[model samples]
Target: MSETADSLIEVLREQCLIQGQNGIKGLSVVFRAMDIDYSKRIVYEELKIALEKFGLLMSENYLRTLFNALDLNDSGGIDFCEFMHKLRPSLKQCRIDVINEAFEKLDVNKDEAIMIDDLQVIYSTNAKQHPKFISGEWTEEQVLRNFLDSIDTPGNPDGKVTREEFMNYYAGVSVTVDDDSYFDLMMRACYGLPIRGS
Candidate 1:
């Protein structure tokens, strides 16, 4: 990465880190704004304009360099997961492992996507008792679908929670938590996974 790109990333990282979870949330909004085509990814042209909107005006060369750096997969565009992970504070290996464990539990079929069927089998009973379901605002299936929609990528709630989507959701939560052990416990409790060293 060039010095300019590195410096830009550092500036954005510091800006986002201070806001914590809201920082991630705000970035999500900005990402959607940049994704004018609703492809859920920002192409070079979109990135260029978005940066200018944020007053980070850069020469074409600088923008290209920074875009390349952010596009880790060289997919020629930046997806929300890649964009978020780049700017958000990284989690420890232990934190990531526990998160993966929770995802595996939810991914009952091991299909890499947590669809409604997997959720029905895994969460149906508990979901029925949810306040919305009990209050008659939503059906049991609606409750499950709502949960999946929350975790799905913005504007692309295809009723499938990909691992990347799951990771991104937790990544937002992880930002507000500073203690690894607390995060681990939260994940275990929320997912109904066995506690470690129990």
Candidate 2:
């Protein structure tokens, strides 16, 4: 990454850490507004306008360079995960371990990606603890689908989630949570994993 890009990422990361969930929410709103096509990926033109919208006036050269740096995949646009990852500080090793453990539990078939089938198996095993299932507002399938949708790549609900998507989703959540143990507990509780001492 260019120094400018790195600096910007640091600034954004610090701001989000200080503001917590509100900072993340504000960034989401900005991304949504900038994605004029609603494709969930910000193209060069869209990014240019977004910069201006935020009162940032950048020369054409600098803007292009920054955009290229953010587009890690060379896919010609920056997806929401990529954008957020750039702005969020790295998670601690403990947080990563817990996240991976939860992901492994969800990836029932040993596939690197979590699919609807995996969700079906896992959710069925834990359905009694699911609020939506207990309240009768959603069937087991509905609960699984909604959970998948919540974490799926933005604007591409393909009914599957890659590990990167899962990590990035939690990266956003990690900023909101200040403590590592709390995050671990949150994941364990949400996924019905046994508590640490148990």
Candidate 3:
């Protein structure tokens, strides 16, 4: 296998392990029932497709539901506070993109934009709310703390998570996202649904 493919597999496996899905023997049992081969990428594609069938992509109902919740004034266009308020997530994605945008906004250093040190205690603040991952559970909090440490560092000597650096390592900037849509990456990955195409 190519190194890239192996890397992806390793990351996927680690994510499963970290998320408590790794040792979920029930996962194997369930896969067996579905006649799925866990070692196969096609299986992941199949699973992802199945999840899409269950609503991975945003339905009109989902958008309207979330939109109504955010439109506090009942007027079109989400205001600054309302935008931040509606941006929070009940669940956490082990990835970093939403936070990346937040960093872009808070990036005081125009030189490198946002650095890891720029982000601390990512709970609800007056300016922003993190929706992808709730700062919940002991390990989850640890993950946040570790993530902060991972990204924060001096520019030249220590070197931290610069906006560019963060995008390269964790955030996928090359993947142009859709604006009129409301869908999660986890759903996309698990279901192999192209954000734009299908």
Candidate 4:
């Protein structure tokens, strides 16, 4: 990881620190809401905090362990070839030719890869909707619930957005996400607009 990547990690570490000051016992919900399990997940945001908590950058093992998961072929080593092959589709879909600082900034949770949670956060934060992103006054549960509700899968009287539903549902309108307003994410989810950005 370079300086930009390190800065991305640092940002996430701070989020964990602020949320988990009471320790893991209290932080579990927030972590799950962010869609990461400490034991199995190895996202950049989580890893950044791990580096801080474990005093990363200073330790070789922590860095090694974080990237070790990318050794999908189990070759005992990871090279550029393998990484590019695996990440090409996602990178393309996300509209990135290379993973750079912008990608890091988009990854609010500090996880290297952007999951649905990360996107939802960015969508909500940038849209400036549902209060939490702007004010940071709600509980983790409240924030997650509000987002899920805002993006609830259509065709149900009560709003319910499951992982399967999120991927499978189609929105009725064409949405240009770069200029998407809060109404854009909200109405798209409610009306089932074809999702554009990740």
Candidates in order have lDDT scores of 0.81, 0.77, 0.37, 0.39
- How close to the true structure is residue 36 of candidate 4, measured as C-alpha lDDT? 40
Stretches off by above 4 angstroms in model 4 are 1-137, 154-160, 168-170, 173-198
User: What lDDT score is found at residue 70 in candidate 4?
Assistant: 45
Model 2 residue 59 lDDT score: 79
**TM-score for model 2?**
0.73
Off by over 4 Å in 1: 38-40, 51-65, 72-81
In candidate 4, what are the lDDT values of residues 1-198, reduced to their tens digit?
455434543443444344332222123233333334324234545534544554335345445544554456555543333332332212122222112333454356764443446656655453355566458777555665565554343212133443332322111111212333543455445434455575
Whole-model lDDT for model 1 versus the true structure?
0.81
Which candidate leads the pack in lDDT?
A: 1
Candidate 4: C-alpha lDDT? 0.39
* Candidate 2 lDDT over residue span 1-198, tens digit each: 678877755755566557654455455566778887778799998878866764566779877877887899999998877786676568899888888888999999988989879987887767556898899987888878888977876545679988877887787788778888899999999888889878
Residue 112 of model 4 has an lDDT of 49
**Which 10-residue span in candidate 4 carries the lowest summed lDDT?**
167-176
Task: Determine the C-alpha RMSD for candidate 4 after optimal superposition of all C-alphas.
Answer: 16.8
TM-score of each: 0.82, 0.73, 0.24, 0.21
At residue 118, candidate 1 shows an lDDT of 93
| Model 1, span 105-157: residue lDDT tens | 88999999899999998889889989999999999899999999887765557
